[model samples]
Target: MNRDQMEGNWKQFTGKAKEQWGKLTDDDLDTVAGKREQLEGKIQERYGKTKDEAKQEVDNWFDRNGW
Candidate 1:
């Protein structure tokens, strides 16, 4: 899925994000408020991942079955 799709499907995406980044708390996802960039920023802040790395991980989740 593309960035737009990710934003549009934020509820699902955030759940997947939490599952992928187990370190991320529900509060962090809520604080990001479904904004893709903010979510990425939060992910980086929480996980110490580079922007591209986080984006790649999110995209990989999207491509995965049952995500």
Candidate 2:
């Protein structure tokens, strides 16, 4: 999903986000609050991923979820 769409539908997507990245806590996702850059940073922090890797994974997740 695009940035606005994500921000608007963040509540709906949070469950899927948790499913996709179980290491991330609800508080972490809440802090991200559907901001793509923040989501990438959180993923990197929780998963020990590089920035590009986190971005790529988020992109892939978006595709998989058809968001």
Candidate 3:
């Protein structure tokens, strides 16, 4: 889903996000709160990935989840 839609459905996505990025703590997800940039930043922080790579991974996750 788009950012707004994702935010609106944040609770629903939390479990899936945690499943996908198991290294992320609940605090990290809470900080993200469904913001794409925040999620990307968290991914980068937790995975040591480049910014673009994190963004791509998020995009791919969204696509796979039919969001």
Candidate 4:
């Protein structure tokens, strides 16, 4: 899914995000809600990953699963 779709479907997607990264909090999900930039930023902040890395990870999951 693209960023807009992901944002629109965040309620469903957040569960997947949490399943992937158990360390992520509800606040993190809330912060990232409906914003691709915010999602990448929060993932980077929480996971200590580079921005590109975080985006790639999210993108990869989306592509791999055809979500």
Candidate 5:
């Protein structure tokens, strides 16, 4: 989803986010709070991905979910 949409529906998306990235803790999601940059950072941190890789992954996810 786009950043504004994500922030608006953060609660609804949290479960899906956990499913997609099981390594992320509830605290991580809370900290991210639907911010795209934070989510990208978390993904990079937890997945050992480069920043560009994380950004592309997030973009692909948004596309896949039709967000």
Candidate 6:
């Protein structure tokens, strides 16, 4: 899904996101609120990933999920 679609459907994706990134807390996902940049930031913070790594991971997740 695109950014707006992801944001719109965030509640639905949160479960899968948690599945993929188990280190993230509910509070972190809530803070993300489906904004891609925020999601990337949270991934970076929780996973100690660089910006590019987080972005790439999100891209891969999006491609796999296609939601």
- The runs of at least 3 residues in candidate 2 whose Cα sits more than 4 Å from the true structure, single-residue gaps closed, are none
Where's the lowest-lDDT run of ten residues in candidate 3? 1-10
* Candidate 4 segments exceeding 4 Å error: none
What C-alpha lDDT, on a 0 to 100 scale, does residue 38 get in candidate 5? 97
For each candidate in turn, give its C-alpha RMSD to the true structure in angstroms: 2.5, 0.6, 0.6, 1.5, 0.9, 0.8
Q: lDDT of all the models against the reference?
A: 0.74, 0.94, 0.93, 0.82, 0.93, 0.94
The TM-score that candidate 5 achieves is: 0.93
Which tens-of-lDDT digit does each residue in 5-58 have in candidate 6? 888999999999999999999999999999999999999999999999999999
**Ordered list by lDDT, greatest first:** 2, 6, 3, 5, 4, 1
Error of 4 at 1 (Å): 2.6
TM-score of each: 0.68, 0.96, 0.96, 0.82, 0.93, 0.95
Q: What's the true lDDT of residue 12 in model 4?
A: 84
* TM accuracy, model 1: 0.68
Candidate 4 lDDT over residue span 1-67, tens digit each:
6767877888988888888877789998898895877877878888899989989987886777688
Where is the poorest 10-residue window by lDDT in model 1?
A: 58-67
| Top lDDT prediction, candidate number | 2
Q: Which segments of candidate 6 are over 4 A away from where they belong?
A: none
Model 5: worst 10 consecutive residues (lDDT sum):
1-10
- Report how far off residue 11 is in candidate 2 (Å): 0.3
Query: Arrange candidates by TM-score, highest first: which order?
Result: 2, 3, 6, 5, 4, 1
Residue 27 displacement (Å), model 3: 0.6
- After superposition, the stretches of candidate 1 with alpha carbons farther than 4 Å from their true spots are 1-9, 65-67
